[model samples]
Target: MSRFALFLALPLLFHVGCGAESGDEDVDPLAGIQIIGDDLSDIPLRGASAAQVARFKEGDRLFDFVFRERDGLGPLYIRASCAGCHEGAARGPGAVQKMVLVEADGVTPAADQAALPYGNTMRPYGVGGATTLVQPEDDLVLKLSQRLGPPVFGRGYMEAVDDAEIERVAAEQAARGDAIRGRINRVVFHSKKNADEAFHRFSEGDENLIGRFGFKARVATLDDFTADAYQGDMGITSPLRPSELPNPDGLTDDAKPGEDVDVETVNAVADYMRLLEIPKRAPADPRGEALFVEADCAACHVPSLRTRADYPIAQLADIDAPVYTDFLLHDLGPDLADGLIDESASSTSWRTAPLIGMRHSTSYLHDGRARTIEQAILLHDGPGSEAAGSVAAFRALPREEREALIDFVRSL
Candidate 1:
């Protein structure tokens, strides 16, 4: 379903009403965004109706539910509940390793026969026992990356963004005369329950659709993302996806097929992630903004994007979303490649992680190796790296300027 993809978000193309209302020279940059608050846990969007708020609570409860062996716990899974790895709705490590084994080249993954179920995700914690699990091969892997789970915040805005906006940004970036050419991950989204039964998916025209969620950007909608997470992460099944994971141990799963949990549980969990609030940020620094732009960081990390005016939430509708991301996939270079070409995203390519609520980030990058953001910044040295120039620019700055720039990023 997902690996620890950093806040996967991109630009919103909405215009603000006016600057006079917020008493600032420019319109409130963060107005209509997540309301500033101390608590960083999942919260409802601004101007949410009473019904919406109630539903948010329901979703939050479902997100917090800890499943047991009887409560549809995985026949062969990694974690039990959504909060098991993502404590407090924030990103964290998983029980079993999210392994994506491939050849030394890392781009061409072997066929399913050579790379069985065990090569993908390592199920260290199975409900039944070791006999009913899928473990990794000892020597088959040339490259294996340990993935962390990303925070599930501000995903609704991402879902509401128009596919045309993503295409427009891709064209604009290509026209800028830069090496940064980010393409959308076009995926075939399936129906809630079955792929062939009923599938009027997220396609703009053809069977393929622009994906916006997950580490590899393989999923297109919040509902599908949630279902995949449930099936893959927790081994829990629902009407949407009613099947146990592959058991390479050649043992019985003991769990029946068809369905494990009801459809309401799936929707509730998805809804919680959808209505989740944006991260809180410190006051904006104009100098930092200028420095961010001057360093060419804004080339890929767009400053502002807009939600559709007719969006569901009053607060999110037509509001200025200052999510600093282009939402397209960019190659971070060989140094940071995962060697796993999932769907359309290349081994070195990753979606532009949204910089909003960056203050709450526990670790940087997909693997959570970079303790500090600076280390993460310095790791961008791949052949297809779009941030190479920006990284150079950041390094060339004076100590104070560099610190100031970093502080500005922290403010986001």
Candidate 2:
């Protein structure tokens, strides 16, 4: 059968069963069931050759690279290395950081927003001298702050996800008349060429795209994000990003002129992240799986999505992807909005984070505010309020059942 046909028939075959009555006996809705066929945890990392491994080792090295005053590790920046922010067990992309700002400027740190109530993961390293390098004439005084985040794992498949599948899931949600709606976060592909140039040239009328990376979904691709991190996070400058983050505050000589880092190093780090394998699931997570589905979490946290036939990776080719996400942005209600708007996402809208490595994560939510999975589940609201209700129903289940749901998440 055609893939489209199969999708069209799913609602009929898997009817939305009636919600259990308030005090009914608990039933296992997903017993002996197998829905998705793809295994995202098994894909191999490219560039693992001996030399590649050597470079990967260097990239993984905690913080040996040096920065110069001109090369931009900040008049103001965040952590010194990717490892600094993303460290520790159970640390994935949803890491948290805390920073305090006493005054306001044109750009407010993401954590400082009164509405958001989270902390900013500020850069620990600086350039020039660690004090204000701004001309004596300028009257801007900003304080240095600190915040931290967890490590990100199993992200390659997340990037490998086909855009079309995300759209299909959104269409399905709209068709079902469910309150939950997921939207893709559009991002700018700065290097994307337009048709007029030997490569394509971008014109004024061309539609600006949505970013699919970062906490706010501001970056587009892993390569771009890596380059950005080199410049913004670590104070390194590459060919792609020639300028350094300005250092109005002269904290170290590293921020002085003519300080540039090698681009190949940055690429190597990105390659390591891209090739890092997804963690495997454990055997004890079946009950959790059942509860996950029964709680209607499957509506947004889709279990399987098939990759398109024409992708570069041979392993990912024609496989059923079980990353457990629809990859669409949804309005998470007033409580979650950051007041910062992107092209396709509103302040309240956030991408449905892929749950490929949830078991390995300590923090939850975009800002990493929820310390536990249960807290994160309870925080769901707005379009996802229905799913939240379903979760509450699952909580009412016997402790074993609840544990099963958590086990299932850990298994993933």
Candidate 3:
């Protein structure tokens, strides 16, 4: 059954009585529906065909494959493989640090990053004896932003969400009196060869496509996301991104010259991400769910959005994906600002976090500063933050009610 159908059927399937025996008699809302566990993120989508499952397995192997210097593993890079940052297909210990050149105020970005050749990414490690650490010039003032790797499971659903749905949500939020307006993050299509792989709404000349991936939502397609990571994070070039980044050694190529991996490899990994399933949610506390909406946290973290019917994957097509994100950029306020500029996303702006796998996540927020879900919520309030009203509402709730809300969110 579809998740939407299952969600709607849950209350009717299990009955709870008023007496103490209700606890014992209550049925499992998700019983036989999903496999709930730590490794759930690693599992493929239900009802995948044999060919799709084979591709998923191939992509899984590639995702975990460690690249060495011979395999084009960088003269300057961050990690050797995708799994280095996204361990277990979820948030891992790895973190990417971005150094933004700023003015005297420390918040305003410098005119440009000409002083820092490697751009904002601080790739401290490298191979081929080009081990000279990248450092800033004496005159340049810099602000460092550390971004922990986000969970990768269920992103295919986000990719499949129709552009119209996002636009509709944006229009709805704009009409609201609350200060919770969201803006679509439009980014240019990077790879010409892969342009045809974009959603059907996009044309041959389309430049600024709706970005649905990354913390800044700067990437539009899952294939591009995979190709970008292979090159940017690992310095392994593919057909999509064939050029090597500038390094201290001034090297223009790696040991494996030309494209390190073929388009097929990139597609395989992208398909794997597309096929990965979200973790099964535990039964939610009804009161807690009600309190979450009461606090207005649902304003930005929308409960669900429907995917496009034409999406190539049958499982993801036209489904109500309960990813709990609007997939639009919003100003989170000054306190959470990182002073880093990414495409159209300002330093203080962040894409609404998807809460599908929150129960399994070890960290919270874009930078992973909050260890606990409650801490994440408490940290939401700041001057000029769109979430200020919601945070205030949450704060005013009684202790039990607050716990209930947090518990409900964690259950996602």
TM-score of each: 0.83, 0.67, 0.88
Candidate 3 lDDT, 318-396, residue by residue in tens: 9999988999998888778878867799888899899877866888887677889999998888888898999999999
Candidate with the larger TM-score of 1 and 3: 3
Give me candidate 1's TM-score against the actual structure: 0.83
Better of 1 and 3 by lDDT: 3
Per-residue CA lDDT of model 2 for 68-107, tens digit only, reads: 3454555555444454445421243212223223334412
Runs in model 1 deviating more than 4 A are: 1-39, 93-96, 105-119, 130-137, 192-206, 249-258
Can you give the lDDT of residue 387 in candidate 2? 52
lDDT of 1 by residue, 1-412 (tens): 2333322210110111222123223343333223445746556776677677767767766776666777767666666667665555566644335456566676555555365544466665665564443334466654556667777788877776666667888899889776778888888765445321122234323446877787667777777877888888877877676666667656434454456778777777777777788866787556777888999888778877776676555666676677677778998887777677768898788888777667777787777778887787778655668888889999999887887788888787
Q: State which candidate has the highest TM-score.
A: 3
Q: Per-model C-alpha lDDT, please?
A: 0.67, 0.52, 0.78
Q: How accurate is candidate 1 locally (lDDT)?
A: 0.67
Better of 1 and 2 by lDDT: 1
